[model samples]
Target: MFKQKYGTTALVAGASEGMGAAYAHALASRGMNLVLIARRKEELEATAADIATRYGVKVLPVVCDLAAPDATQQIIHVIGDTAIDFLVYNAALSFIGPYLSTGPSTHLDIAAVNVQTPLALLHYFGGKMVARRRGGIVMMASLAGFQGSGFLATYGASKAFDRVLAEGLWYEWKPFGVDVIACCAGATATPNYNNTHPRKGSFLEPKAQLPAQVVEECLQKIGTVPSFVSGTGNKLVSFLLSHVLPRKKTVKIMGDSMHKIYGSKWESN
Candidate 1:
């Protein structure tokens, strides 16, 4: 029952599935009207229907790819004339290959959605939240974003960008009564894993609370914590790497792992 102190309106991007859909439902359960965004119209519709039926809360589904060229403007258009109490930027993408193996354009595109889009989201609605003087904005980042991962070079880097920006915003917006948090999630059972290496220790089987639990916890915590790392293992790793490992060593280890996973793909690129 620990929702944001702000009024009851929550907007979640990437709500077609996984963490996004879960966040939508969590807010709905707390009596917040919902605005869900994602590229798949049918999937968004299905998610909206379930939340409406299960929680008896209003749900609005907008189909737009955050990675699209005009994603920010499109998202802004959808929020017109509506006040949002909470904003969860939960969209994500991953390209698995070494730095050279991946095309530069593809890597930059990852930045467009993962890094630029989040900043743009902040640029658009952030002021409204600050002016109203209430609300929360959560950025969905991964522990991998904490450091460079060789095969997932662009993805890891983008996450790095997200984490840094989230923390910076928390400080900048705190005076305005707006809270920002970056959730550093560990590996979860999401469809993004299909492109990954099977034997890599990176995979964490879905269990217990699942992605839904993480989403729910995030909503419940809002202003209580400015930054958080989900999952014990992931948090443990984050702590250890910061205290025990050197950056050079960590990057090398991750790079070697990427090489192992990508094989000749890294060399070809």
Candidate 2:
């Protein structure tokens, strides 16, 4: 029961892999043509070909880092003259480990990928959507966004900004029949886990969620809510963390764990 059923066209960032790939497939299954953006050109092309073959949706690939200055304009150009009714701004980068230990430039780059690009996408496409008065957007956020972290401070903080921004926009746009969803997904298995957490295993190998679970959720509920935490387990963790744990304690525990796992990777696991 997607509130905004896929009809005309859709734009998705980070559409080459993980949840973004799942989202592109779901939208294609709903009969929407897609313009997909990702840093990897070959991967984007491959995904487009697969989707085109299987779902028959016209898939356009825009290879971009998105953290670059020209990214917004480049995307706008690709979307020229297309009536985009759905936009999934799901591309994000997470650099785990201590904030102070990481280089300032690296943190800035993380901000560029996680916060800046999405902001640009919203500004560029949101204006057009509002003018048309018919579009829906999902800004892929994480449960990590809900609170501060010790090891993953920058990533969590940026996602916090994303979640709030999406919620604020959702309220302002829904009356215009536009839905801005802030999806807070928990630890669903994706390649990016290495970037987000201090782990050393494939997200697949039966540990975390398959990409399909997140995609399935996004497809079923397009615009009914401002936010949707992806899995029940994730939802529960967020709930407990929100209600049970004190801020200082949580930060301490997270920091210690990170120190054990990532900050000292040379040490035996």
Candidate 3:
């Protein structure tokens, strides 16, 4: 198995819920123990208990707010001497509004979690993986990364950085037996998604997929490829946006969609 080539422990950041928890479940099912990290201590504990019960694998829940300044060090401290064979950078922050109108602090917080944390974690764990000559890294990116969207400018940009970083790491790490992949998924049916976009059906947009399905696709594609967009509908849309349409038009269309979703809050402070 792909996972067997790596060690027995996997660290999944943001594993209290959504796609993060899904990855935790998938990893446990593969007979790997888990170290789950997130800010929500209660949710993290609950998820840890459930996964441990179901899979009979050790599950440790580390509650560290990724937005906190010392998050990377806190996570490493919580991990202690556990050998993390797989690292999944899944925690993220989504701030939807006009970029200029948003506070600088908000942007910094988003950058800390979405961009800085991943790079720091990779630098710490990736070194170990290379030294051991076996490991994997899965970074959660998004379709928004492909284009510049009005309301989602910062989030999109952060994810784009993630995608490119993972692609580059895949090249550099492949020779060292470390698998790296950027799993870019679109409109997943996470609790956050259901809460945000309640009325689902849309002629222009594909239905949001289940978290399990998206995470499964990510795990399956990890060792085989550098990057993959999860859904079929997402793939087509991404292809058209990048290849067929003008970049300006793509951005405008995405902005219009976000406006529809966020309504009065689209560009308003």
Instruction: Show model 3 residue runs off by greater than 4 Å.
Output: 198-202, 265-269
In Å, residue 149's CA in model 1 sits off its true spot by 1.3
Question: What lDDT score goes with residue 40 in model 3?
Answer: 88
Model 1 misplaced stretches (Cα beyond 4 Å): 1-4, 194-197, 202-209, 259-269
In candidate 2, what residue range of length 10 has the lowest lDDT sum? 198-207
Candidate maximizing lDDT: 3
Task: Estimate TM-scores for all models.
Answer: 0.89, 0.90, 0.96
Encode model 1's per-residue lDDT on 27-63: one tens digit a residue: 8888899999898999899999999999988888888
Candidate 3 lDDT trough over 10 residues, lowest sum: 197-206
What are the lDDT scores of the predictions, listed in order?
0.79, 0.79, 0.89
Q: Tell me each candidate's RMSD, in Å, in order.
A: 2.8, 3.4, 1.7
- Residue 269's lDDT within candidate 1 is 52
Model 2 alpha-carbon miss at residue 203, Å: 18
Candidate 3 residue lDDT tens string, 172-231 = 999999999999998988888777753432356677889999998888788899999988
lDDT of 2 by residue, 192-243 (tens): 7645564622221123567788777865666788888887766766666678
| Native-structure RMSD, model 2 | 3.4
Q: What is the descending TM-score order?
A: 3, 2, 1
The positional error of residue 94 in candidate 3, measured at the CA in angstroms, is 0.8
